[model samples]
Target: MSDPILKARGLNKRYGKVTAIDNCDFDLMPGEILAVIGDNGAGKSTLIKALSGAVQPDSGKIWLDGQEVAFASPNDARANGIETVYQTLAMSPALSITDNMFMGRELRKPGLMGKLFRTLDKKAMEDFAREKLAELGLMTIQNINQAVETLSGGQRQGVAVARAAAFGSRVIILDEPTAALGVKESRRVLELILDVRSRGIPIILISHNMPHVFEVADRIHIHRLGKRAAVIRPSDFSMSDAVAIMTGAMEPPASMAA
Candidate 1:
C-alpha cells in the first residue's frame, strides 16, 4: 500500500494500575476500511479515544500524511480532517438535521447582521445539509427541518454518517455503528460505511460483530491485551479465525510467526 494516511507508533496510555494502551502501533491506508476487533477490555476503545483526541495518550507519536502531529482535543482532530462518530452519535435529538450538522461551527449572516447581531446563515446551512444527506441517499427525509428525534434508528445512523462524510476530509472513525440496530438497520449502516469509503475517505471501524467486520472491512487489525496483535487481510482470515485471534484463543497466522 502507499504511505498510510494516518499512522501511529509507540502509543501508550494508563489509568493508575490499569494500562489502557501498551506501546501500540497502527496504520490506516488511504481509501480502505480497516476494522479493529478485540474482546472486552482489550483497549480498543482507548486506542480510538487517543486517536480521536478524546483522551491524551501518555506517550506516542502520530503522523498524518507522514507529518508528526498531536491532537489536544476532538476539535483539533476534526480540524485536521479526522472525524469520529461514536455509538451515541453526539447529536441533539431535538434539533433539525441542519442544526445538528452546524451545531458548533455555524455559518453567520453577512455584513452588519453577522458582525453586530451575530445571526446565523440558516439557508446556507440547510442547503449544504440537504445536499450531503441526499448524496448518502437519505431522500426519505421529506424535510431537512424535521427534528432528528422523529427519525428512525437507521435514518438517524444515516444522518450521523452523512454529517461525518460532509466534514471528514481524510478519515472517519466509526465505533460499533450497528451495535443497537436490527438486522435490516444494521445492513443499512454497513452499506452506508461502504458508501462513505467509496467517496475516497478511509474508514477505521471498531466493531465486535465479526460478521459486520468481515462484510465491510478490507483489512482487520486484531487488538489484544492493550496492543495490536496482528494486521491481516479479510481474504486471509475467516470470521472464526479473526474471532479466535481477538479472544486470544488462537495465535496469529503463520505470516506473523516472527
Candidate 2:
C-alpha cells in the first residue's frame, strides 16, 4: 500500500526480567482500522502504551508520516497528532459535554492588559462541539450542558471519540472500546469507529471481541506471548482463521504471519 501514517519497527517493552512486548512491527494507514487481538498478557496493552507514549519501550523505532519520532510522554504523543482513548473514558461525570470537549484546551478571551483572561467562550465552544458531534451522527444530543454520567454508554463513548477527533489528531487509538457495553451499545460504538475511519483518520483498535473486530477492522494483527504473531488483511482470512490465530490454536496464513 501507500506509505503508512504510523509505523513501528521492532517495538520491545520489558519489566525487569519479563519481556512484555517483543519485536512488534506494525503499520496503520489513513482511513483504515487495524485491530490487535491476543490473550491476556499477550502484550497488546504494552504495545499500545509504547505507541501512545504512556510507557517507554526498551528498544524500538517509531515513524510518523515517514519521519522518525520518539515521544517522552503522552502529551508528547498528542503533540505528534496521536490520541489515545482508554477504556475508562477518562471523563468527569458531572462535566457538561462542551466542558468535557474542551477540558484541557479551553477557549478564553484576553483581558486586563492580556495578563488576565475573561471567561470561556461558552457559546462558540458549544456550537463547535455540537457540530462535531453532529458530523459523527450524534446530533440526537440536544443539550451540550447535560452531565456525561446521564448519557448512555454508547453516547459517552461517542463523546470521547468526538473529543479525540476534535483535537485534530491524525491517528486515534481505542483500547477495548466495547468491552463493557451491551450488544446494541457495542454495535453503536463499532459504527462510530467506522464513521471515524471514513473521516480519513487512521485508527488502531485494540479489541478481543472477535465479531466486533471482524465487523470494523480492515486488518488484524495477532499478538502471541508478547510477540507479533501475524498481520492479516480481512479479505485474506475468514473469521474462523482469525479466531485460530487469536487463540493460538493455529498459525497465521504463511504470507501474513511471516
Candidate 3:
C-alpha cells in the first residue's frame, strides 16, 4: 500500500486536568477526502490543532510525505505545505479578493523596488489569484478586486478554499466548511472540495454534517472520547453506521479500528 500522505500517531493533549486527545491516531491518503467526525468536545479540534501547528501535543509524532516533522505554529505547518481553512474563514472583510488570497505571503517585486523598498508586486499576486479562482470556476465572482465582505457566505468560502488550493502544495485541512451555509451554498462548497481533490492534493475535512461527509469523503474517520474509534468507507457503511460508531452505540470490527 502507498504510505499515507499525512499521518499522526500516539498523539496526546490535555488541559491541566482534562484530556483533549489521548493516544489519538490519524491518516490521510493522497488525492482523497478524509472526513473527521466527532461530537462536540471530543478532541477533534485538538487533534486538528496539533496537526495544523495551532497546538502542540504533550506527546506524539506527525509525518508528511513519509518524513517525520514537528510544527511550532500554524506558520510552520504552512511552510511545510499544510494549509487550513478555519471555520471563521479568517479573512479581512475590507480587503480585496487578491489581498485576502495572498494575505501573509504576498509576492514582492523583483528589483530594488521589491528588495530595497519592500514593494509588493500587486499585478503578479492579482494575476495568480485570478487564475486560481478561474481554475476553480469561481469566476462567477464579478470583480477580483471586490471587498470580501461584499460577497455572500458561499463565495467567501469559495475564496478561502481557492486560497488553500493555490498554495497548499501537500494537504488542505478544512474545518466545518459547510456549517453556516444554506443547501445551495453548501452544495457549491462541496463541489469545490471535490474540485480541489481532483487536482491531486489530499484533503482532511473536519465536519459534523453527515450527508456532506457521506457524499465527498472516500473514507470516514470516526472519533470518540479523544481517539479514533474506526475508519470506514461510506461505500461499505451507512451514515447511521458511522453515527453509531462515533457515539459508541456499535463497535466497529477489529479490522476497522485505527
Candidate 4:
C-alpha cells in the first residue's frame, strides 16, 4: 500500500537449539489492521516480540517510516511512538482508571508546584482520561476514581486500549486482546479495535481466534514454521483457508509465493 509505515526483512531469532523466528518478513500499512496469526509454538509471539522490541532478532533489518532503525528495548519502541498492549492488560488492580492511564507518563502541576514539589496533576489527568475513554465509547462507568479491580474485563480492556489510542501516535500493537473476554465483551473489544484504527493509526494484532481475525483484520499475515508464510487480504482468504495455511494443509496463494 503506502510504503509500509513499518517494515522488516530477514528477521531471525533463536534460543539455544530452538529457532523461534526464521527469516521473517513483515509489513504494516498505514491506518490498516494487520493481523498476524499462527498455531501455538509457531513463533508468532517471537515475531511480535522482535517487532515490539521485547526481544531482539539475531539478524534482520527494521525500517520505520522508511528509515532503518534498531530498538534496544521495549521502551525504545515506545519512544519511537509504538505502543504494545499485552494480553496482561498491565493495569494496577488497586489503582484508579486515571492513575492507570497515566501510570508512567503522569502529568505534573503547572509552574512552581510541578517544578519544585513534582506533584501529579490529577485533575488534568482525570479530565483527559475521561475524554479519551468517552471517545472510545467507554464512558459508562460512573466514576473514573474507582479502582480498576471494580471494572469489568471488557471495561479494563477498553481502558488499556484508550491509553494506547491516546499516546500511540505511530502504531499500536495488541496481543490476543479478547482471548479471556466473553462473547459480548469480545465483540465490544473488536469494535474498539476498529475505533482505534479509524483514528488514522496503523495497528498490528496478534490473535489466535480465526473468527476474530476474519472479522477485524483488513489483511492477514500468516505465520508458519517459525516464519511468515503468506500475507493475504481477508476478502481473498476464507477463515478455513487461513487455518489450513497455518497448519500446512493448503498452499498459500500463488500471488503471495515467497
| Among all candidates shown, the one with the greatest TM-score | 3
Model 1 clashing residue pairs (backbone): none
Compared with the true structure, all predictions reach lDDT values of: 0.91, 0.88, 0.95, 0.92
| TM-score-best of 3 and 4 | 3
* Candidate 3 error regions (>4 Å): none
lDDT of 1 by residue, 1-258 (tens): 599999999999999999999999999999999999989999999999999989999999999989987999999999999999989999999999899988778999999999899999999999999899889888778799999999998888889999889999999999889997899999988998999999899999999898999889999999999999998888877888888888889998778521
Q: Report the lDDT tens digits of candidate 3 across residue range 1-258.
A: 689999999999999999999999999999999999998889999999999999999999999998999999999999999999999999999999999999999999999999999999999998999999999999888688999999999999999999999999999999999999999999999999999999999999999999999999999999999999999999999999999998999998789988
Q: What TM-score, computed on C-alpha atoms, does each candidate reach?
A: 0.97, 0.94, 0.98, 0.97
* Residue 198, model 2, lDDT: 82
lDDT of 3 at 76: 98
The Cα RMSD of model 2 versus the native structure comes to 1.7
Order by lDDT, highest first: 3, 4, 1, 2
Cα lDDT for residue 10, candidate 3: 95
Question: Cα miss at 171, model 2 (Å)?
Answer: 0.4
